[model samples]
Target: MSFRARTTAVLAAVTALALGGAFAAVLVAFNGLQQRQLDASLLAVARTEAVEVHQHALRFSDRPGPAANDIGPLTKFGIIYEDSGTVIAATYPFERTPPHLADIRHPNAQPFNFLFEREHMRGVFMPIPQHANTFLFLATSREDFEGDKEYLFRAMLAAVVVAVGWASLIAYWMSGRLTRDHRNIAAVARGVARGDLTARTDVSSPDPEIVQLGSDMNDMVERLAELVSSQQRFIAHAAHELRSPLTALYGELQQALRKERDAAAYRQAIQQALEATRRLKLLANDLLTLARTKQDAGESPEAITLERMVEDARKLVADLATSREVALDIRLPKATVSHRHGDVTRLFRNLLENAIMHSPSGGVVRVESEHHGSMLHTWIIDQGPGIDEEDQERIFEPFFRAPNAAKTRDGSGLGLGIAREIARGYGGDVQLDTSSRAPGARFLVVLPAS
Candidate 1:
């Protein structure tokens, strides 16, 4: 599902739960209030009846020949009287009356007011106040309280149903407002995935989080556009560079075969052709390595022993060093220092070759390795003319040639660029040290130790 739809669904569910809980709470509270009101009404009826009974007893105490004549209309209450420790009057008719003096001695045993149920009647009790040995009990039927409770419950249930419907409507409307941005973001993301690089999500609100998301996506697209454009330019430049050498070699080979020439002249022409072919071959190999590195970009990375890899790489370049009469010095710890292996050999090879190619004949090219905390530091120092301090930063850029070095040496100017690329791929970096102590040039390689 789309982001907007999912967000709406989750919000709706939450709203439903909140509204359901609220409805239940309100219903329970309303029922409790109703019950309290019903109890109060019952108590009021009991109090009114008690007063009437007390007045009647005071009026009939002197002329009580038969208690039934003094009794008045009891209304909804059932009345009973105890006189001389015997049942004197009762509003309820019974074939055999209950004994009154059985448990009347304990005044605290039953309070003056209490709920009572006898046969079908159910209500509260209120003792009549009189000096004579008499008691009055007044009660009404249970149906009155029960009917009130039923009505309150029905009304509460209806209110809860109505509340749920109204709450659901409000929740859906609010959910739409909240998820509107999410919908726009999703639509823009789809467009971007479908090759619309210019597509961008709208951030109409002032919310920081939403604004940040939109800004980040736009920044990513811009970066991607720049990268694609650079790649296109690099391919065109590389193609032209490759074609020039090939064209030169082809022309030289064609001229050599056109006619017979002196041995020295023929040798010179063949040597020039061979040199052109060799440069073309080197360019092709460099391009291939770069392409392979890019292809294997996101594979699993593991700790590689830098010391061992460096030693192996030096051994590979040993023949080249001997050809130039250059000495190699390797300084590394005994403990195994490690980093990612991917493109690490390339990084070392490029730096070592660049040093060797620039060094004077018989000059010593030093290869040193050491560990500094979490980083494995290695440097290739040459005894050639060091780059100027101002030009050090631009040396690693692709095809960037330093004026001093450009005058002294013939190079494609891609070695340092390739070395830096390799270093970056392995989570490391390459830098040129322009200090005075070892002033020829120091290509420092730093890789994270495992």
Candidate 2:
């Protein structure tokens, strides 16, 4: 069933059950009250007639037929002698034989009581205390009581149906409001699934939780859109970067192959091709490392000393520093950290290489590390032209080469970006601290200290 219909049905059923129970209780109590009143009225009539006989205002012998004086609503069935069970005075002539005394017997008969039900009539047989030998018999039709109960039942049934119908209508309206809100949210989600990232469940309701849920869903979609856009931008930039070296390598090889040349000329052409191939290989490796660091799974972290990592990075960049005619001044502490050995090694190697490439001849590329509380802070300071403030923020973007570095340096810009990615993978970060140094760039790496 639809939500509205189900809600209406449940509400109606519950209301009906509640109303039915309450009405049934009222009917039962009212019926009992009516019966009590009937019983009291019968007793009162019996008492008054008995009192009149005792006061000499009535006589059984004089009133042997229908009563000449009214004795209230109950019809008198005449006075009887208890010992003989014979009618002495009757309000009307006996049309049918009376019940046998033994059949009317009550084991513990009270003063105003006997078993007297016949022909759809019910009454009581009462004995006069003043006249020990005499008893009164009176009865009335049960048609009036039955008729009142039937009328009450019909009225209650009508009231119940009206009440349930009204309640059902209200329930249906409320359910519609709730389901409409849900439908709006579902529509927004469907739009998002169809790649419409701008779609949102901008719903307003009295319900706080539903409103909060819609807000959270909108936030999630916005974040997902941002991530997908960033991925696309990265792919475009990577393609542009890879095409440069590939085109160079392809052109050099094509020229060498066409129109055979002297050995000296071929050797020079092969060397240039090898140089392009090496640059392409380096770019490809950096791209692969960055992609791996972005993935959700890889090698688990292990305990490795920061000092040993610095040593490894220094050795890896020794050739580059020597070629650049730069001095490496290493100052590292004996601190251990929990990190993937290969990732940390590559991260430090990239930073050292970048520093060495940027430094002028005879300039010092200083490496320093320290343990501070729960973090290991490392600094790689290069005596090169400092990064401009405008480019600091975008310095770590993949394949984003700074203007100065692009003009003077012979290296891809992915080194610093890959270094930052690897550092962040270990719950650490790498950033340029321009304010902390002058006439050079200072790159800081912070990792968890074990």
Error of 1 at 148 (Å): 30
Mark the 10 consecutive residues where model 1 has the least summed lDDT. 61-70
Candidate 2 residue lDDT tens string, 1-450: 876788899999999999999999988898777667666665565566666666663444332222212233534454454657775554543435666555554322232333344344445666767777666565555556667778898889899999999999889888888878787888888998999988988778889998998899899999999888878878899888789888988998999988989999899988999999898888888888888887656668789888888889889989888888999998888899988888899999999888888889999998888887898899999999888889999888877878888866666668888898888887899989866747889999999998
Specify the highest-TM-score model's number: 2
Clashes of 2: 1
Q: For each candidate, what is the lDDT?
A: 0.65, 0.77
lDDT of 1 by residue, 1-450 (tens): 854456556755675677667766876786567445544555565555556666675222222111111132223544355655555555533215543544333341132323333434334444565535555444444444456557766776676666666666666677677777766777778887787877877777567898888788778877877677667767776877788899999999899999999999899999999999998888887777666654555436665576677777787778888988888777766535344454676678778878887788888878777888877778889998888778876787655667877765445557787787777766778998655576589888887777
Count clashes in each candidate, considering only residues at least 3 apart in sequence or on different chains.
Answer: 0, 1
The deviation in Å at residue 135 for candidate 1 is 52
Highest lDDT among the candidates is held by which one?
2
